[model samples]
Target: MAVTKAKKAPTEGAPVFFIMLRNMLIGLVSTVATTLMGAAAKGDWLIMLIYLRGKDGPDKALPSFLAPSTNGTAEHSVVDEFLEGYGMKHLHLFILMGVAGSFIIYYPVGGFWHWYYYVKRRDQAHEWKCQPNKFLTKENEAHAVMMGSFNMMLGGTLSGTIACYIVNGGYSRLYFSIWDYNIAYTVLSTMFVFMLNEFTVYWSHRIMHMPVLYKKIHKWHHRYIQPTAFTASAMHPFEFLLVQCLMAAPIFIFPLYAGSYVGVLLWTYYYGMKDHSGIIGESQWPWQQDVMFHDDHHLYFHVNFGMNTKFIDMMYGTVRKKDREYSEDIFYGFGREKTETKAQ
Candidate 1:
């Protein structure tokens, strides 16, 4: 007798790989363009000219304090002056790096885990089919990339420039070192920022979901019901600005000392990226689980609306209940029970 062969199950790994690769490419291109634009706006040409001229003209000359400060009248030392100048020249570069870094660190580790454990597994088992309506086409994917990239550049530039100015203007000590700063106070301040911004986001997001606004603004985002990383930042300009403002307002209103402020900004960006990721799983460590709560909401929208915690969603009963009944109805017609009894 001939032996029978078993067919292999189709794998979901390829689709996931392509999705991540495409999004990462888009992000890289966007970051490069934004960095170039930022560099041009910050008088980098002038800095280059000064470096080339070698003390021949006023524009070419370095500041006196940077030149050893013979009088030493509390002016910046040579090291300090160099650091100050370098910081100014490359501020935008650092901002771009910071944003990119967040994505890099979050995806391969946190995102991979979530995709493997939840999304990919579901896809393979055919238990979680992406609604046809939710699939992103090539055109929509391009739109999402453009929208998300532009918004990120705008937000990053605005916040980075403002923070740089604050730090350079005699507040350098505040933002220089996390260890030297009041850690407890910084943590508290950071948490406060998260809470305030969450409320702002909730209301703003809700408003955008309304019919009139949804068609004009929020629909672009909802277009990606099965969102990729690029989908995180994709939004209408107005909506993008609104969210950025909500994230920025607390920083401006209740300013942290410089070092603490830097910490807060970094933490905020990391959280923003994490919240948008599609992955959902806890790490070996307990605290790690808290990271994916917001992202979970975005993946399954009826629940997990709160940014920092599930408090609001739970209290309001917005938590998503698994629709076992709906699934059964889909598999077996709604009146199956009555029909089955009559047949019997």
Candidate 2:
């Protein structure tokens, strides 16, 4: 026959590969749409409210060193030019991401817990409260929220500034592409960062409890002896800045995937509020300490300095011994003495 027979109509819908590809694309699009909607709902789109470019024109009054430049100048390197031209354009958004994004996360989370446990279910949660007899007064609660907000804003701005500086300066080993190394290495690096952070946090916190640092810097936070969720960030601005520095230090010290870095931050934020909430709860993992561990720190200062893990406290004997009174000298192996305060 001159012409080939017409191809038989396919009974099955499509090839399995094509079907799978279509499903994957649909899932991806749905995920993106969902994320965008969530961001919009959370007011992350506030990032779009400000820009370096003004309605009149680019702000030219800024000093040459500070101003964004598309062309390299004789005094500045190509790196500087690229940073100025590209990174500087997003400085406002970076700052907002730190300030607004932190508040967006912190307020909602802390507020919800505060409302549920402190206000709405006070009677129900009273038994589970680590300090059942103790609670921040309403005035004190307001003050705590105010101070926390102030410190968070200042700390967030400082964080944003440092982030802009380091990222634009190319000082950190933070990478976006997971394949730059491998998934295993990325995970290993994240674990390493968390462990290192725990070490630094435990040591720094213990140091802050030292006589001089405690009176001058750390006492501000301890004022909330029975801290609420809102009390999490209620610290001196200096202490807040120091924490930001600790947070930023790790990226410089290791090759951190951006996703891992963000995840660490989110966990830190949530746990910080949770632990300060005065709610008694079991540890999520065997390695992690319960919120009561920190509640005890606030209840009885100078012990339980470990943040996320009990390993350091166990090793250093900083763990609260119910049968003994902990003294500052415990750090030197000489302070704990027998006491009659029954374990809660």
Candidate 3:
């Protein structure tokens, strides 16, 4: 419930412990739901959704997937036996999670919001858009959707597998009940993952805006001055690799739980989409510098380069002022806005 203004800061932020507590609560909810969704007990009749068995330790989790929803090939689908015979059934889970995260979460949510606020509630135009009339074309929309969808799936699959192997020691991380898993572990691990992810995106975003890199790599992402939901994840695969891949960095150092990792990325995908939707208004985690901050990044590229928090951008003196001017570049030519006429 806070809106930041330039380098000046919020009077105060919710305590760090409270943020960690909230992450723990989110982990608890998401873990239980994903655990059940991936759960299968022979003859539950829902076996069709999850034909394969679990892989992690008895009280652990895995990136497993739902069995094929088809009935063929000796009464079993090709996918059914392929995973079992290869002993890589967990691959199915990773692929399924990736596809679901990409299509289900990333696709429809942002699209719906854009239509909801922009089309249906057009009267709130000024309230919503930081840079009105600078819409993405059908071509840009299609490119963004296709590229973003593919990257979301790819990033999820790779990161899930890596995290699964490391966190579970090549096993699952599911427990029969919530009491079995330690809230301290889940909460601390989730907070680590969240903070690490923020650090990754903040630096990656600033690096992309460098002059030599901008025209070569990040320019395509800046095509839509007034981006919508579909444009949330739109970026060059190289850029996605630079920024999104860091979500897995915590796993290499910290012992992040498998379920906790998934929860963190789910937030990243969902919230990051909203961040790019170009909608400027009150949000649930306004203190996180959600909408206006990111919209300002797209509208006035010279400022607000940090993601999820403005601390880094403010420190770098890149936070945008209402009447900020974009005239020159310093280190790597990061400043490239309206010296003449920028995004309006």
Q: State the lDDT of candidate 2 residue by residue for 226-266, as single tens digits.
A: 98767777888788777767877877777887678765654
As a TM-score, model 2 comes out at 0.70
Clashes of 3: 12
TM-score of 1: 0.51
Q: Which prediction has the highest lDDT against the true structure?
A: 2
lDDT of 3 by residue, 187-295 (tens): 8767867877776777777777777888788877887677776665567778766664465455456455545665565555545655666766555564467687787
Query: Residues 153-253, candidate 1, lDDT per residue (tens digit)?
Result: 56556544444444334222233344555788778866666567666766666556555776677666766655555566677767766765665455456
Roughly what TM-score does model 3 have, to 2 decimal places?
0.65
Pairwise TM-score winner, candidates 1 and 2: 2
**Of the candidates numbered 2 and 3, which has the greater TM-score value?**
2
- Each candidate's TM vs. the true structure? 0.51, 0.70, 0.65
lDDT, each prediction: 0.48, 0.66, 0.56
Pitting candidate 2 against candidate 3, the one with the higher lDDT is: 2
How much is the lDDT of residue 83 in candidate 2? 46
- TM-score pick, better of 1 and 3: 3
Instruction: Estimate candidate 1's RMSD in Å.
Output: 13.1
